[model samples]
Target: MKTAKILKVATFFSWFACIGLTIKSGAILVTYLLSISNPEASKNMYESLNLFEYYNHSFLNYSIIVFYKIVLFSVEAYIAYLVIQLLKKLNIKQPFNIDVHSLMRKISFAIFYLWIIAIVHNTHIQIIGKKHNFELSLFSSDFVFLSLVIFIFAQIVKRGIEIQSENDLTI
Candidate 1:
């Protein structure tokens, strides 16, 4: 029972983390779009607010980054939904039937790997003109690491679900 509770808590945290990522990505997208649509206004606002002084790049790169983050966030959110469904199935005492949890686990792993690649690509672009050694922005690195951690936790929860299912079948 305690194990089940722990799994539930972990699942909740994973979902929360995914949602937080989505929100962060959405904010980035909005900022990028606003900057693109009104460069002067955006620049003035940035100057006044004293934010993003380091992002001295063209709108094209901003657009591309925003698009990438949106796609990644969407994928992560979908995976979270799948995890939630798997949890629901486990809660309702379903007939030990499908390998949905395993499938979701693999999908989550794949998405996390892709996210890491995207972060690397973005970081490469951000450091193009800078004289830094493989410069990675703090935000990008943090999100990548957070996604990896969430996926790892998802895999652990998946394994627990599989084991519990097997135990149920034996009884």
Candidate 2:
């Protein structure tokens, strides 16, 4: 009983994390769109958008970039943890139920779509000189591929859970 309750709570957290990911993903998409729509305007806006000067040293800019990367990485890591919990909830020992499978498929599809969008956005930044030289296209591609694989695995697990549920119901 306690484990069930814990699983439920974890699922809720996963949903919450998904929401945050969606918001952050949307922000990145919007920024990318804006940049593409008006490159000159985007450049001007970025140049004028000064959050902090930090005693006239340029190191602050790099620090801020590092901080943003750290936060983004942390969010991604949390989402991955939540995804694992969700997969555990599927209890993939049995298969035949449709509900769990369907839900998992939808989530997987959404995540894949989001991954594609992120890759596109990142690529756009790299092309536009907004990203650093260290940024590689392969990195974005790998992230998208990994996300797709994880989501697909989740869907497979959910399908198993559904089948189990159906067997239980029939018996």
| Model 1, span 1-171: residue lDDT tens | 786887699789768967876675666566666766555433333214212333445445544544655666666666666666666556434423355555555556756666675676566456652543323333244445655676676667667768877897999
Q: What is the lDDT of residue 127 in candidate 1?
A: 69
Q: In candidate 2, what are the lDDT values of residues 1-171, reduced to their tens digit?
A: 776688778777767776765565455444434644444332322324221221123334433332343344444645555465445646534333454455555556555655665565455435533444332222243555666776676677666666766777999
Return the clash pairs for model 1, or none.
none
Cα-based lDDT at residue 22, candidate 2? 57
* Local lDDT at 3 for model 1: 62
Best candidate, lDDT: 1
Q: Locate the minimum summed-lDDT window of 10 residues in model 2.
A: 47-56
Off by over 4 Å in 1: 40-56, 91-96, 105-109, 112-116, 126-135, 138-171
TM-score of each: 0.55, 0.44
Which residue runs does candidate 2 get wrong by more than 4 Å? Answer: 18-96, 130-146, 154-171
